[model samples]
Target: MNKIVYTLLIFLIFNHNFYATNYYVSNNGNDNNVGTIDSPFKTIQKAADIMSSGDICYIREGIYREEVIVSTNNLTFKNYQDEKVIISGADLITNWLPSDIGSNIFEASFTGAETQFSMLFVNNKRQKMARWPNNETDEMMMPEDVKTGYEDCQVFNTRSGKNGRRVKFPNLSGFPVDHFKGGIFRGIVGKKWINPMGIIESSNDTELTVTAISDDWGTNSSKMFTDNGKGFGFIFHLNALDQPGEWFEENGKIYFMPPVGKDPNDMVISAKNRKLAFVLNNRTNIKVDGINIHAASIAMKNTNNCEITNGSVQYLWPFFTRKGYAVSKTEQGGIFIDGNENLFKNMYIAHSWGHGIFIDGGRKNKIENCFIDNIGWIAQFTSSIQNFGDGTIVTKSTLGSSGRFHIRTNNKIDITYNDLYDCMKMGQDAGSIQSTNGGNWGVPLDLKGAEIAYNRIHDCNTLTDGNKEFVLALYLEGCFNYTVHHNLIYNFKTDVVPDGTFVYLGPRMATIKDCYYYNNTVWNVDWGLRVWNRENRGDVENILFWNNIIDGKANDGETSDNDRNVNSLLAKLSFKTNIRNITGNGNALFVDANQGDFRLQTNSVAIDGGTEVSGITDGFNGNAPDVGAIEYGSSFPDVGSNIDPEDISFELISDSSTLSTNSSDLKKESIVVYPNPSNSLIKITNLSNNYIEKISWKLTNLNGRELFTGKALTIDISSLPVGVYFLTVNKTKTFKVIKN
Candidate 1:
C-alpha cells in the first residue's frame, strides 16, 4: 500500500509538470533541459528547442551571444523584463600558432584605435624559424633562448607625430607585435610587408567559390582561399588585447564575437548573416502588438494573415565601403508583409533604411491610423516593371517570366486615416508610394475596388533631385472601381527643376469626388494635375473630378506652354471645370491655342464664375452642367434637409376635413420644431413668430426620465449630448409638445 501511494504521487507530479510548463531562459545554468522557471535554461535556443506550439519562452535580461533561429511554427520568444535581449557573436580566436621569425606572419596589433584586431586567420602552415647573428663583437658567444632572443625580431615601423620609420628588430616568441604583415621570411625586403588586408563583403551562398594560391616557385600551392580571400587573415590574439573575451560554441553553432553593447545601434563585429529580429513568414492568424524593433537588417518577410499594431521600427545607418567607394545605406524595416490578408493599425514606423511597412504581392489588406515618417518608402504596390523604373529595385524580371507582379485584383484594400510624411525612396525595383505611375507593375494589374480616403498626405515630394517631376501627390493609373475622397492634401511641391510636375494621372478611369482639397498648393511645378491618356482608346471615361480646390500660384507665372496642356485636356473633354467660390490669387485656367474648339458654354456659370451648387437639389446643376466637379444650382432639391417650420404641426386637426382653427382662439396650440435630429446642439425656434409670456419647456427620453427642464424664450443648449429627446412647451393658456 505504501509503494502504490508513492507511485501515484510521482505520477501526479509528472502530469502537472507536463501540463503547466512555463520555460524561462537566463544567463545562467546548463542549456539542455526544458527551461522551467526554477531550473531554467541558459540561452534562448535551449528554451526554443523544448517549446511546442502554444508555448511561451520567457527570456530574462542579459546580452545573449547567439543567433536564435525559430523553427517551431507557433511558439513565441519574448523578453520578460522588457529590456534589451542582445544575441551577438563570440569574440575569441581558438586555434592560433606563434612564430619566432615573424616576417611574413601577421601578428595582432596592440593599438587601441585599430579595428582590425579581431579578425580570424585561416589556412595556417607550419614553417621553420630563421635567425641572424646577434652582434658584430663577441662572435664566440651564442645567444641564450634563440627563439625568444633574436629570431622573433623584425623591422618595426614606429610613428612619431606625422612621420614613421622602420628598424630591425627584437627576437621574441608570443610577444606583442605592432602592425605585422603575414608571409614567409622575417627581415626580408620582399616578404616583410606581405600582411593580408582583411576584407568584408556581403554575398549569397551561390557566389561562394574556392581558388588555389601560388608560392614563390611559381607552382600552384596546396593552400586554397575563399572568394577574394575575405575570411583569411590574422588578427590580434585575445590575451594580448585589453578587453578579455571568450569564444562560445553550442550544438555545433559557433559564435565569433560578443555584442558590441546594450544599445541596438552599437556596431557588431561579425561575418555571419544574423537571424531576423522579427519574422512573419507564411503565417496565418498571427498578431504582434506593441513591439519596438530597431537596428535590424532584412528584418521581416514572407508573412500572411498577420496583424502588427502599435509598434515602432527604426534602422541605424552605418558607413560602408563598396569597390573602394564610401557609401552609407542602411537596410532595415518595420514589418515586411509578403503574403496575403494582413492588417497593420496605429503603428509608428520611422527611420528605416527601406520602407516603413513594405507590402509586396499581397491581397486583401487593411492599413489604418498608421503614422509613417522618415522612411525610405511609404507604401507601394505595382504591376509593371517599366512604370517602376528609376526607383528602388525590389525585384527584377527574368527570362521567360515577368518580374514581381502584384496580381492582387479586387482585393478589398483600404488605406485610410494614415499620416504619411517624409518617406523618401522606394526599395530595389520598387517606387515610392507616388511612384510606379499608379502601381502598374506588379500583379493584380489594377487597384480595382480600393479606397484611399481620409488620409493626410503632405510634404512628401522632392526627395530625389534628378526626377523632381517624379514627385506626386496622389497618383492613380490602370485602376478601376476606386474612390479617393474626403482627404486633406496640401503643400505638395516639387524640387527646383525645369521639368518638375505634380499630381500625375495616367490613362485610367477613376472617380475623384467629394475630396476637400483645401490649399492643394504647389510650387515650381509645371502643372497641378497632368492627365495624359496615351492609349487614346477612350478607356479613360467617367473620370469625375468633383469639389476639388487646386491652388497652383507658383506655376502660374511660367511662360511655357506646359500649363496650357492641362487646360487643353479639360476643354477637349468638355469636362466639368468648376472654378467658382475660389478665394485665391492665380490664373483660373489656361487653354492652348490649338484647343480653341473646346470652350465653356456662354452664360454657362462655369466659365469665369460658377453657380452655387452646394445646397442644390439636382445632382447636375444648370441647363448645361458645370465643367468642373461642382455643378451650378438647378431646380432639383439640394442634398441637405429643407426644414419647413410652418409645415410641422402637433395639432389634433380634423381627419375627415381640412377644417380651420383660428390662430389665437384655440385653447391648445400646435408647436413646430426646426432642425430636428440635431447634432450636439439643437435649436427650438417657435414657428408661432409671436411673443408669449411664461413658456415652460421640458425634455424627456424614451424611459420618461426628464433630461432637461427649463423655462426661457431661447435656452442655452450647448451642454446637451447626442440622442433622441422629447420637448414640451406650456404657454399661459395652451399646452404644446414636439419631438427633437
Candidate 2:
C-alpha cells in the first residue's frame, strides 16, 4: 500500500467518535464470560474484539499471559483495581534433567517452537549467554588479530590465537572448542560500539567464519581495522556453560548451570515468545494507566489524545533471534507512538534491549515526569527517547544512564528541567541531548522556534578506544532559529582526550544561523562553546551569544560570520575572519565556583555588568542585567526538577520540588563579609573559628575576571574604581563584597 494514501485513510477513519462503554477482564474468568467487574472475560483479546469507540477495558489483577491486539478506536486498557495487571510474553519453565555432557550442567526441553527465543530470564533477571573475559575491561583485543569478510559469511582470521567458532584466549580456555562446529558466535568486532552475531559455518584453530547476523554490518564493520581497531568475541554453546547462571540453547533443547547447588526444577526460568502487548492502530482518546507491561512492546499509530501514565513497559526484547545474525529492530521498542497530542507521564521504562520510547511523527506530544533508564545495552538499539516530531516536549523527567536522548528533523520542541546523564555508553558522536537538521533525509524541515533550556545535561559520549569522536552536552548540528538558554552544561570527561565539550554548534556540512546562546553556566568543560562554518553549505551567521558564564575555552572557526556576543567569561572570543558589526566584550570574569554553584556573590562584578537584551533579559533585579543563568538579586533559577526519576506512584504529586532554594542553603554565617556597598576596604567575619584560621580569599568581577588574590580578610579596594565585586573567603565559600 502507498504510504501517503494509507496515512490519509487512517486520518479519515480516526476523525469520528462514538458512544462510550466500560468492560472488564480477569485471569479467573472464562473467555465465554460476559466482561463485567464481577464476571470478567478471561482473555484480553476476547474483550478487545468486541470493544467499541470510547470503550474502556479494565483488566483485573492477575497475569494475563497473552499478547493483546488492539483494533478499536478511543478505547482504554488499564488495570481493573490497585493490584498488579501483568501482561507478559514469557512463559515459566520447570522441566529439567542433568546434562550428560558436563557434571553440573542441566538440560531442559521446551514445548514451544525452537525459534521462539534467544534470550532467557531466571528469577526475573536476564541470564548471561556465555561470553569470555568474564569481566568487562577497558582493553579489548587489538584489531590486527581479526579480519572480516562477507563471502564466507563465515571466514575470518584472529591474531589472538583462539580460533574457529570458539574463543580460547590465554586467560580463558575450556571445553568450548568442541561445540564450535554448529554453535553461534557473538562478538564485539571493532570499537565496542557495534556487535555482530553470526552462526558458525566453518572453523579451525586460527581461522573462523560465519554469516552476518545483522544487516547494519554487511561483510565487516566499515570502521574495523586490522591494526588500530579493537573488540571482543563471545561464544555461547553447551560446552562453554562452565559457570553458574550461564545458559545455552540448541534446537528445542536448553542447557543451564543452576547457580551452585540449586536445582533447575526449583528455579523459575522464563522465555519470552510473543512480541507485542497492545497494537493500537488509528486509536484515539484512550488511556492505559497503572498496568505492568512486561517482555513485550506496544505500538500506537495514527492515534490522538492517548495517554500511557503511571505504568511500565520493561524487558522487551521483541526479536531474540539466536540463529546468529543481527536483528534490525528499529521500529520496535517498549512503546512506539505516532500521532498527535499524546501524553506519556509518570511511567517507569527500563531494561529494554532497544529504544525505550520512540515517537515518530506527532504534534504537541508530551513525555513528562517519566523515568527512562537501562535501555539499549546493545549498541544496535536506538536508546532512550528518539522523537522525530514537531512540538514535542520532554520535560521534568530523568533520562538515561545508557542510550542517548535525541531529537531529529523536527521543530517547536522544548526539552527542559530534566536530569540527564551517563549517556552514549554504547554509541558515539552524540550527547545526552542532541538534535540535527532534517535535511539529511532529503526533506525540507524547519528548526525555527526550537528551545533547549533549563536542562541539567552531563556525562555524555564517555565510550572510546583510540579514535577521536567529539561529543557534547548540547549538540545542535545544522539547526537554526533556536534559543539555548539558562542551561547548566558541565563535566564532559573522556578517557582518551578532553576533545569533547559542553556545546558543539554547526557541523562541517551544515549551517547554524540566527541561533541565540544566552545566560548559560558552563564549568569543568574543555570547550565552553565550539562553532564551525564550512564552505560547502551556508556560513555560521548572525549568532547572538551573550551573558554566558563559561570557565572554559571558546573556538569560533575562521569562515564563520560575525558573532554578536557580549558578557562571556572566556579570555578571548575568537572569530578568525572579521565580519561586520561583531561585538565581543565584558568577557573576562571569575566565578568562584564551589561544587556546582555558579551564582553571583553579593558584590561580584558580574552582578550588573551585562547590557540589556531586549526580550531575553527582561526579568532583572538590579539597574543592569546580570550575566549567566542566575540574576543576583532575584530568585535563583532552577536548572533541573527534583522529582525522583524512579517514583512510579499513580497519584497526583505536586511538581513544586522543581523550585530552587540555593539562596537559603548558602546563607551560612560561618563565612560573612561586612560593610554594605562600601568603598575600598571591607571587614570579614567568621562565626566558626576554624574557618578564620586557614582561609584564602579571591575577588573577581561578574565577567569572571580575577581582581584580587590574598589570604588576609582585610583588603583595600579604595585605589580601584568603584563598582560591584565578589569576594571569596575560602575555597568553598563565596561572599558578596561591594565597593563604593
Candidate 3:
C-alpha cells in the first residue's frame, strides 16, 4: 500500500472542485452521451467541450447546425423548458429536381466546394434574392448619363421602353440576356441614401458595363446622379428568376420559384453558408435565453457582463462588401457588441443586411425593450442602434426600416423614451436621430455629456430629393455639452425634396459647440431650427435655442456654399446672419397647425411666452417660462423624467420637476380637445376626474396611415384628407387636430 495510494489521489481532486454540473444538449444526442438529463450531449461544441465557469447548458428542441465559439465565463445557455431551440447556420437542401428550362423552375445541386450560397430558405420562408423591378409596377428609369470615370468602369442606361439588359418582357417578362455577364447592378445612387452595386463588366441590350468593385457610386462623386429614376434593380442570375418568392445561384446551381402552391419536393430548403451563428469571444457572466437565433452572425467580442434576453435574431445576413458611402462598415448586423456592461433586453432583431445593433468600443451598454426592423437597405452607415459607446442606453425601443442614426465619437450617451418611426428608409443627407463628434484613431473627438430626451420622433425623411436627396428629423453634427429636451418631432415629408428638417444642426467639416435646446416640439416640418456653417468649418458656437415650439422655420442664417436652403419657408428666413451667440426666447403659437398638436393650447399664443434663462429656465410656468418644449402646465418628459439625469450630471438643478416636467406627471387638467383644428367636429374630454368609460383612438395621416379607429367621444373628420392629422389618445396621449 503506497501510503494508501497517496490518500486516494487527494480525494479525487477534491471531488472535481466541488460539483457545479448541468449540461444536456441534443439533436438526437450522442457525443458519447453522459451529459445527464437522461444521457444527452451532441454538439453545442460538444457542450462547449465540457463547460466550466459555473456551467449550465440545456439546449434540447431540434435543428442545431452549429458554430458557437465562446471562451467560457459564468456560462448559462438555456432552452430546455418550453423547447424549440434552433441555432442554424444553414445546411439542409434535400436533393431537389425538375428544371430544364422553367415551368415554374426548380433545381438544387451543390457539391459544397467550400460553400458560397447567397441565402435561400423554403419551409421557413425567406427567399427573394433575384431582383429587377419584379412587380410593384416594374419600376425602372434612368435614360441619360451614368458613365463614370472608368477608374474601374461603370455604365447604365435602361429607360426607353426597357426590355434592354437582355430583354424578354410581355406577360411574366424575361431577362436571362445571356446571364448578363457576371450580374449584380442595384442602382439608386447620388445620395438617395444608398443602393450601390455594380459588377457585370459588359453586357448589351440597354447599357450596363459595371466593374467598379469599391465605392460603387457613392461617397459623393458629385452626388453620382441617376437623376431620380428610383430604386433600379437586378440581383442574382437565372434571368432574374421571374417572380414567386424568387431565388437564384448559378455555378453551384440553385434556381427556384415555388410559392404558388409549394412543392419543391415537400419544402425545407435552408441555405445560409454560415458567417456566424454564435461566437461570444472574450466571455463574461453570460446568459442567453429563449433562443431562435437562425442563420449566423452574433458576436460580442471583448464581452463583459453579457446578457441577451428573450432572443430572436432571424435570417441574419453578414457579409458586406461595401455598403458605405460616407463611412461605417466594420461589418455588423444581428448583434455585434464590443464589450462592457452589456444587456440587450426583450430582443428581436429582424431581416438584416447590416446593423440592428452594432456598438463599437463600449462602456455601460444597454439596449432595452428592443425591436429592430428590416434594417439598412445596402448601407450608408446603417442603424437600428449604432452607438460608438461611452455610457450607452437606447431605451423603450421600436426602430423601423433602418439606415440613419449612426452616432459616432461618443461620450455620455442616453437616447431615451423611444417610438422612432419610418426613418430615412435608405439614406439621403440623413437623420432619424443622427449624431457625430469629430473622430479619434483618425483624430477629432469632440462631443461631451449627451442626452437626447423624451422621444416620439415621427414619420421621418422618406428620401427627400430636393437638392438631390437630403432629410433630417434631428441630425446633429460636430460636438459639445448637451441637452436636447422633451421631444415629439412630427410628420416630416416634403415629397420630391422640399428639403426636410425638424432640427438640423451644423459643422459638416466638424466643430459644433456648447448646446442646450430646451422644451422641444416641432410640427409638419420643411425646416424648423436649422443652424448652418459650411466654408472652413467651425462657426456655430455657444448655442441655446430656448423654450421651443416651432411650427417649422427658425433657421439662424447663412445659406448656399454647399449648405443650400433653396426656395425657403418659415416665412422667408430671417433669424439674423452668420450666427454667433444663438438665442431664440419663449416660443409658442402652433395651436393646432391643422391637427398635429404642438401642445400649448388654452387660447394659446405660446402661453407664458418665456424669457427666464438661469440654469436654463429654472422651472418656470406663468408670466415667464413658456415658449416651448412643454410647460403650459407640464406632463410630457418620459421615463423617470427630470429632463433626464441619472448620472451623466453635467450639474445644476433648481427642479421645476427637473426642468419642464413630463414623465407621466400629467396635469394641465388631464385631457381635453375641442374644435382645435376641426373642419368636421372633434371632441375628446377626460379631465382625469375619473369616470373614464373606454377611451382609445387613433387618427393618423401625414403617411402614418390609420385614418381613424374607434371608442370615441365624438369623431367625424368629414371623410378625411386635409393633410397633417394625428389623434392617438388612449394609446397614451397624442393630440394635434385641425381638419380645417
The sequence of per-residue lDDT tens digits that candidate 3 reaches over residues 617-679 is: 676776677665666656554431221112111011100111011223323334455545555
Residues 1-740 of candidate 1 have per-residue lDDT tens digits of 69999999898766643553567776654577556655567776777566665576765533454545455555555655342333332221232223232222222222111111111211110111111222222111111224221222222223322112232233223433322222112111122112111121111211211111112101211111111111111122222222212221223332232223211111122221232344446545444444433333222345555666554433311111111111111222224455555665554443322234444455555554444443321112212111111111211111011111111122335444443333222211111233222334222124444555444444434322222224444544334455554343444444554333334444432322222222122323334555543333213434545434344342322122333333433443222343433234322332211221112234533433433334321344345334332223321111111222233221211111110122232223323343233333333433233433445777766566877777654444435554556666762222223222
Judged by whole-model lDDT over C-alpha atoms, candidate 1 comes out at: 0.34
* Count of backbone clashes, every candidate in sequence: 49, 27, 22
TM-scores of all candidate predictions against the true structure: 0.43, 0.71, 0.34
lDDT of 1 at 537: 23
Instruction: Please give the range of 10 consecutive residues that has the lowest summed lDDT in model 1.
Output: 395-404
Query: Between the candidate structures 1 and 3, which one is better when assessed by lDDT?
Result: 3
Report lDDT (CA) for all predictions: 0.34, 0.60, 0.60
- At residue 232, what lDDT does model 1 achieve? 13
lDDT of 3: 0.60
RMSD of each: 28.7, 21.2, 29.1
Which one wins by TM-score: 2 or 3? 2
